[model samples]
Target: MNPETAKPATAAEHFFDRELSWLEFNDRVLQEALDARTPLVERLKFVAIFSSNLDEFFMVRISGLIERERAGAAGSAPAGMAPSQQLDAIRTHLARQTALQHRLFDGELRELMKQHGILLLDYAALDEPQRGALEAHFSGQVFPVLTPLSVDAGHPFPQMSNLSLNLAVIVEDPVNGLRKFARIKVPDTLPRFVALPQGPDQAGWTGVPLEQLIAGNLARLFPGMIVRGHHMFRITRDADFTVREDEAEDLMLAIEEEVGKRHLDGFVCRLEIERSMPAELRESLMEELEVSSRDVYEFDGLLNLRDLFYFLSLPLPELKDMPWTPVVPAPFQAAPDESGEPRATLFDAIKRGDVLVHHPYHSFAATVQEFITQAAHDPQVLAIKLTLYRTSGDSPIVRALIAAAAARKQVVALIELKARFDEENNIAWANRLEDAGAHVVYGVVGLKTHTKIALVVRKEEEALRRYVHVGTGNYNPKTANLYTDLGLLSCRDDLVADVGDLFNYLTGYSRQDAYRKLLVAPLTLRRRMYELITREMEHARSGAGGHIVAKMNALVDPEMIRHLYEASRAGVRIELVVRGICCLRPGVPGLSENIRVISVVGRYLEHSRIFRFKNGGADEYYIGSADWMTRNLDHRVEAVTPVEDAAAVHHLEQVLAFLLNDNRHAWDLQSDGRYLQRQPAEGEPERAAQALLMEGARLGEF
Candidate 1:
C-alpha cells in the first residue's frame, strides 16, 4: 500500500458535534444535582442552572439550526452533520437528559427536601386554613394582574412571549351550552413559589407552585362559566439576532430595535407541555404556536425547573454550602506604617510590579473596581479609557466613569451594544455615559468588541505614564463573585503602550494591526497562535519535549484543533481544560494520542482563558479574553496579553497545575465524545481545585 495514495480523514472523523458537546457539558451540570455528596440546596441550584442553560441553548443554537434547516442551507457543521441531522441528534440526546433531570427533582430532591422539613406542596396538599389564606391572598394580589385571553372567533390565538409559563384553560358556558379555550400567563412579577402560612405543627418553610394556585382558582378568573380543567405549558422562542452595522445609521438605536424585536417577534422554537394535557389541546397548541411535533416536549413533572432558584433564597443555611467571601490580595491591602497610616493607593502597588488578581478567590471590588475608582478621583490622572462589554445594573464602575467625566477628566468608553442578551443593559449604560459628557463610542464596525481592557494615563512629574488592566471576564462585580476569572494590573512600558494602542483602535480611526506584547484578535492572535503551535511541533520533532496547556471556556476552531492534532502526532503533549463546548476529540489512538481534554464545572463558572506553551523548556504564558473559537479569533475584537512578570506567570502556572490535578468537579473527555467525571481512588486524598484555591487565598499564598 502506497502511503501517498491513501485518503485523508474527514473532519467528521476527527471532531465531535458542537451542539451535542455543549449538551454533554450541561449534563455535567445535572450530574452535580444528582451527586448526593453536594449540599441539598446547592444541588437544587444546579438544577436551576441546568434549566436556564437549556433555555438559552434552544433560544440561540437550536433556533439557528431550525432556520438553517428551513432555508436548506448546504453547509454542514465541522463534525459533518447537517442542520437537520444535528437537530434530530439534539432532540434524542435532550429527551434522555431531561428525563434524568425530572427523575432527580421529583424522585430524589423533592423527597430529600421533605425529610429536611422543606415542603414544595401542590394546591391539593394545602390544608383548609392554608387554602383559605391563599384564596384571600390570590384575590388581592394575583387577581388584579391576571389577564385571561379567550381564544374565540373575535380574538386570534394570543401570542406567547418567550419562556412564559401559561395555563391552557377550558371553561364551559352553562347558559349557552358552549365551551371556550383561554390562556392565562402566570405573572413573572409574582414569585413562582407562593409561600404557605405555617400551621402550628409545621416546623420549616412551605410553598405552593404558583401555577397550581392559578389552576385551582380558574372559576374566580371566569365568574359565569363552568371551569373544566387547566394544564401548564411553556414555549421558548428564537431570541438570537444580528444587527447589520453597515446599513444602520445609529448602532445603539439599531441594537435597541433588535432587542425589542427579540421579545415580541422571535419564532417559537420549543413547546413544553404537561402529560395531562389532552391530545386535542396539545395539537391545537402545536398548530397555533406553529411548532412541529419534533420540537414538542412532554413532561411528567414540573414544566420549568428553573423556578427551583427560589429554594436557594430560603434561610436554610444547614442545607447549603458555606458561603465564600472573596479576599483582597496582599498587595492591594494597604499595609500600615509605623504611624498606623496607610502606605499607598492601588496605583502605587502596580508601580512596584505587576499585581495579579483571581476572582471568586481575590476580591474584584478591591482590585479592578478600586483601580477605576481611584483613577476617577486622582487629580494627576489625565484620561481613562475602558471597554464595556457587559456590567451590572447598578455598576460602581460606570458611576466612577460618570464621576470622572463630572470632574472634567478625559473619559472615553467603548460600549459594545451588540452583546447578546445584554443589548438593553449596554444601551442604558451607553446613554448614561454619553449624558454625563463622557465620549461613548459603539466600538468598531463589523466587529463586536469582546476584549476586557482598561487604560489609565496619568501625569507624574514631567512625564505621562500609562497603567492597564486586562482580564478574562466582564467588569461586572456581581458576576465576578460567581466566576473564576483572572486580571492583571500592570504599569509596564511595552504592555501599557500596547493596551493604549488597542484602545485607540477601538475608539478612533486606527487600523492598528500589530502589538508588541499583546495579542489583538482578527489580526495577530490567530497567526501568533498558529506560529506557537508550529514551533511546538518543530520542538517535538527535534526531541526537545514539547508541551502545551490551555484553559478556556471553549475550543471550537477547526484549524486550531488541526494544528493541535499535528503537534500531538509530533509527540507534543497537550492538555486542555475547557469549561464548555469543546469540539476536539482527544486521546485517539493515532490521531491525538498525546492530547487530553477535560472540563471543570462546579460552584464557580470557569470563565478565564489562559494559554501556556513549553517552548523547548523556555515556557511562555498568557492570560487574556480570547478563547480558541473562530468567533473569538476571527470575528470579534479581542485582546490577549503575555504574563511577562515572573510572579504573574508563576501564579498562572500554579492555576493550571491545580486544574489538571483536580479529581473532583472535573470530567475527562474520551475519544468517543463521552465525559467521565474524575473520582479519587481508594486511599487517595481528595483534591478539589476550587476549594484548594479558596484555602490558598485565605492564607495569602497566591
Candidate 2:
C-alpha cells in the first residue's frame, strides 16, 4: 500500500509528544529483552541499557522540565501540552514505565542467576553463616567509609550530593528517653555488590547488595546506641550549568571551572525508601533534599538501578550471547593475494580515486581512522582539516592529528564544546590540538558543528588534490564498532570543493554560500528536503513510481513530519527506518496511511542516515550526519552529501531494502504511536537486517 493512499480524515490529531515518543523508542529497546530469540544474557544487557537510558532522560530532559516549571515559563510541551500538564503526564507515564523496568530487571536477574547457579540474598533472606560473612565484609570494607549523621536539637539535617544514596536512620537513646535521626551515605567508591564468603549454610555463590550490607552494619557504626531503623534513599540535583559568555575571557577555562562547580546544586529528582518508613524520617529526608512528593520515587529494590550495570558484567560466557567480532571491509581487509594490498591502504586508494565504506560490515578502524593516520604521516600530505565531536579515550584519530601537528604539518581541528556530557573531553582535545600548534576552533557561537567531515590536502605533482572522508557517525571508533554508519573516501573535486568550503565556514571566515554537492544544515538541508518532498508529490500526481525511503536515528521535526504527511496525502510511497524517537503517526486514516515506519533494534545500532527520493523512475540518494530532528536541520551544523557513485548508491539502497524487509529486529509503527512487530508468516523466512549483513560480511571475507 502506498503511503499516499490514506483515507481522508475529517479531523486531525496534533503532532506526537516528543518526550512520550522518546519513551516509546526506549520501550522498543526494552522489548528486546522479552524477545526469546535474543540471548538471555544479552537480553539482560538490553534491560541494563533501558535503565541507563532512563537515568539520563531524568538527569537531562526531566531536569530541564523541572527548571522550566520552577521559572514559571509559559512554554507548552512539544505536543501542545501545557507545561504543568506535560509534567503531570510525564511523571505518571514515567512511574508506569519504571514499574515495568523493575519487573524486567528482577525477572532477568533471577533467570540469569538460576541458570548460572548464583544467588542474590536480601537482608531477610541471608542465612546465619552468610550473614556472619557479610558482617565481616561490611566491617572491613564498608564501615570505614561510612559517615553517620544524627538530627537533634544540637544537630540539623545532613546534606546529600546528587544521586548519592544515603540511609535515613531512626535511633533511640532509651536511657535518655530521646529519639534521634541519623544518616550514612553509602560510599560511592565501594562497589554496589559485595560477594559473601561461602560458609556451610551457603546458597551457592550468594551475595548481598551494598545498601543492605550497610543496613546490617548500622549497629557496628553506632555501637551501644539502640539502632532503631534505616531506610535507603538517593537525591538527584539540578545538573544544568550556567556560564555567562560575556564574563569569560577563555570559554574553555570558564566551562572547566563551571563544570567543577556543578557538583553542588539544588535537588532536581529524588528516590526515597520504597517500603514502609517512619513518616518523621521521610519528612526529614524531604526537608534535607529540598524537594516535593513529585520528585520522589518509592522503589522495591535499590535507589539506583543504574548501578546494576556493574553486576551485569558477569563474565559468564555461557550465560551470555554468542560473541561476534566486528569485520573490516573485504576491500580493505581482503588477503593481499586476493584483493591486492594496495586496496587496503585507504589514503592511497582514495588518492587514486574514491571509496565508500559501510561500517560494522566494513571496519571503521581500518577505514576512517586509517585514512586520518595516513594523511597525518604521509610525506605527500601537507595539510589536514577535521571535525572532532566524540571519540574514545585512546582514539587513533586524535593521536594521528597530534602527530601531524607535532611534525609541523598543517592541522586544523574543530572541536564542538557543547557536545553534551562530553564537553570536558572535547575541551581537553581542543587544548591538546591547540598545544600541538594545530588551529582549533570552538565553532560558531551557539551553533554545534555536528558534521562529521575531514579534508586532507596534499601537494600531488605540484598541484594540490583533496582527499576527504565524510560519515553519518562520529569519528569515535568505539561507537563505530556498534553503530551502523556509512563513510566515503574521495578525491572527487566537486565533493572536495564543498567539504573545503564547509571547513572554512567552521574554522576561518564564515562563508555564507550555497553548497555545491552537499546539503548543509542551518541553511539548505531542510529546504532541499522540503523541495524533494514536493517533487515526490509532483511525481505521484504524474502517475509515476513516486517513493521516499529515509533512515535516521530520529524523526521529530514538526515541519518535516508535516511534509511527510502531505506526501502521504499526495500518493507517494514512503517507508522510514527510524531507529529511535519517531513522532509521525503512520497507518492512520486520511493522515499517514501511505506512510510506513519501522524501527530496527539489534546487536548493532542502526545509526546511518540515508534518504532516497524517487523522481519518477530516477532516484536520488543522500547520506549524512544529521537526523530529522529540529536541532540537526535548523540549529546545528550538519552535512548530507549525495551518493553519486553507482556502486555506493546501490549499496545504500540494498541496506535500506534490508531494513525495510526486516522482521526479527523490526517493529512496525501503528497510527496510535505503538510499534508492533510484523508476525512471521508460515513457510516465510525470518529477516534480521543486522544478521544478514553479518552473513554478507562473512561471505565477503571468503
Best TM-score goes to which candidate?
1
Model 2 lowest lDDT segment of ten: 3-12
Model 1 segments beyond 4 Å from truth? 1-9, 199-203, 337-341
Residue-level lDDT of model 2, residues 1-702, one tens digit each, is: 444454433222546777777888888888877677776667767877887787677777778778788888775534666556667877787788777777766766666666666676787788797788778777787878888887777887766676787888878887895778888888889988887776676443567788888887777877878987888877776666766656778888888886665566545565546657767777767776767877777777666776756655666677565665666664455346555555345655665455679887787777788889988888888999999889877888999999999989999999887776788888888888889899998787667889999999888779888888889999998898878999888888899999999988887777556988899998889999999999999999889857999999999887788888888888888999998898788877567778999999888889899999988878899999999999999889999988877777777877988899987889988888778877668988998888887777767631
lDDT of 1 by residue, 1-702 (tens): 222233333558798888999999999999999999899999999999999999999999999999999999865657888898899999999989999999999999999999998988889878898899899889998989999999999989997899999999999999998988999999999999998777798788888898998988888899989988889999999999998999999887888888998876999999999989999999999999999999999999898999899998988999998889899998878888999988698888999899999998999998999999999999999899999999999999999999999999999999888889888998999889999999999888999899999999999989999999999999999999999999999999999999988988888899899799999998899999999998998898889988999999999998899888777777889999999999999987667878999999888999999999999999999989999999999999999988877878888888999999999999999999999999999989888899989999999888
Candidate lDDT values, in order: 0.91, 0.80
Itemize residue pairs with steric clashes in candidate 1.
none
TM-score of 2: 0.92
Tell me the TM-score of each prediction against the true structure.
0.98, 0.92
